[model samples]
Target: MLASMPGLRPDQEGPSLAEQMTALPVATLVVRPDNSIADANVRAETLLNMARSAIIGSDVARTIRIAEAGARFDIWHSNKAVAAYDIKVHAGRTAEMELDLMIAPIVDHDGWRVVSLHAQSQARKIGHRGSSGGARSAMGAAAILAHEIKNPLSGIRGAAQLLESSHNGQDSALTQLICNEVDRIAALIDRMQDFTTDRTLECQPGNIYPLIDRAAGIAAAGFARNVRITKRYDPSLPSANINDDALVQVMINLLKNAAEALEHVPKPRIRVETAFRHGVSVMVGDGKGSAVLPIEILVIDNGPGVPEHILDHLFNPFITAKRDGQGLGLALVDKLVRDMNGFVQYSRDREAGESCFRILLPMGMA
Candidate 1:
């Protein structure tokens, strides 16, 4: 009865699973209850460099050879409901690429089956070149304007100081206001200068655990003292190539934002997590050809989360969620990370009631 079902096979009345899965962007493959290749989408056929007719009805293990170079049919045929394995596939006679294969069991009228397989390439990585260019232009213009205003500001501050010394009562108060305003402007300019300056990254392979711990310690003792801090580090994580000082700056900026976001919430908390991520890559270009990105650092905070209105422009210059914020902290951070060939992105986690920021950096090439 199942073999005669319309959706069971191409000879039947209904559309096959291969037809439905071919519409998806990712490659997909369907296996029969006996661990045989029942069907494959167009993407999967292309990835395997084989024709659909030749692949269908064949053993799934016959087409895909895992990195271990052994028959993987038994793994999928096991009683396990789900399984995953990484493999490097020969794209052509000479080309090889890595891919992550996920196998999941499904039940249908025919019987129990496995539907799995997706081709992941490391060559296709994305970067933030466009946004980085915009940040550089804006930061440069602000630096120029800040520099032009610096000299006149000093004169005004000196005049205000002199006036305050010679005046009394309300007159002195007005002079003090002028001095205070000038000082604030000067400090703002200093922050802008830091953003504009071009400096070569002093990269060295260093474990990130200690760096994160140091940042948490500083936050716990300072503005974030009232907030509880949590650390989750993957001990198996390898050393990351980064400038210690710059990385520390990045951590502090994120911590400060997290602290401020949780200020009014009950039982405020912040979490820092580090681990090796696979199949996560950034595209450096908008075109078909883009490099694959690797490695990620995640910082999460339990707060109200980023406001929906300005969420898209969080990395833009002069964007701040706080009332008294100058809004240059994250902009500067974006610039510095971009300089090191990395990208920063943020997302609001409604389920977790927090805002998540992830930093992606390329691992050292072998």
Candidate 2:
């Protein structure tokens, strides 16, 4: 075994270390006990501009050099994980590249480590740092804009509604349209405020199946009327600690996005699945340790998938693939999930021709 967890066996249960490394999108290298490069994935081959055959069994120090003095040796000596960001890297004979590195020792193995590298360009594009300065600035600006526009929007809607009763024929239809558009703008403003608000949700132990079904039912009655919806849930899945309203909101947003994406597809289909995923956890608020997240919810869609240009920023505010989208749906979904100590991720299953949004929530403590 390349690595071992306390009670989990990679060989029988989940992915093997080699398989996981190969699946990663970023470049990865495994270092042997003797400081030789044990393995390099295809991404590593491309980044280092060398064949995998040539990279394996080569001296780790000579093949991948970290410009941060003693940074590489420190992890080796301490046997601890190290995360070095925006550091210079020299790969083989290639010119220097700024990259982020995640170096961690292989459990149950001595002097064996796995190194993952993210090029600066890739890192900048896909990195989700919503708490960053730029994101905060954008959110601040939006909050102000939403506040200023909401009052006027409500007035416009009220005026249109009053005028609708007095108008006839084409004029009546126009008044109703004005009211509808104004209400739509008001709704958009409310969603935008979710990004600026810092409200804490009161989470409780509850069955997640009901919430998922409720959201799906709502979608079927409205935007997803023509779309095929399927639900495959693990009945034995444990209760998750989540805010009922927040979970429903998150599901509805995801389902609506999926329905819209499949608007032009020949046979559009969306699947909502739930299961107990083993060995999944994330850092807790205190940052002293992590909380296990075993409950998994997936919203899978067979559509054209998100545009590649905005895939990296799919959850970022104002980054959208839709022509008329305000892009706060996923952003708000991200916030609400995190507030409940859960996490979400999106991936495109190229072979299956599907887009999947996976949400993992912690089991109820009670």
- Global lDDT of each candidate: 0.68, 0.78
Question: 275-301 in candidate 1: lDDT tens per residue?
Answer: 776544333332322223355788888
Query: Whole-model lDDT for model 1 versus the true structure?
Result: 0.68
Q: Output the lDDT of residue 75, model 1.
A: 46
- Candidate of highest TM-score: 2
Off by over 4 Å in 2: 1-139, 155-177, 284-286
Per-residue accuracy of model 2 over 186-236 as CA lDDT, tens digit each: 877777776686667899999998899999999999999999999999989
Best by lDDT: 2
Q: Tell me the alpha-carbon RMSD of every candidate.
A: 9.8, 8.8
Q: What is the TM-score of each candidate against the true structure?
A: 0.65, 0.66
Q: Ten consecutive residues with minimal summed lDDT in candidate 1?
A: 121-130
TM-score, candidate 2, is 0.66
Steric clashes per prediction: 10, 0
In model 2, where is the ten-residue run with the lowest total lDDT? Answer: 281-290
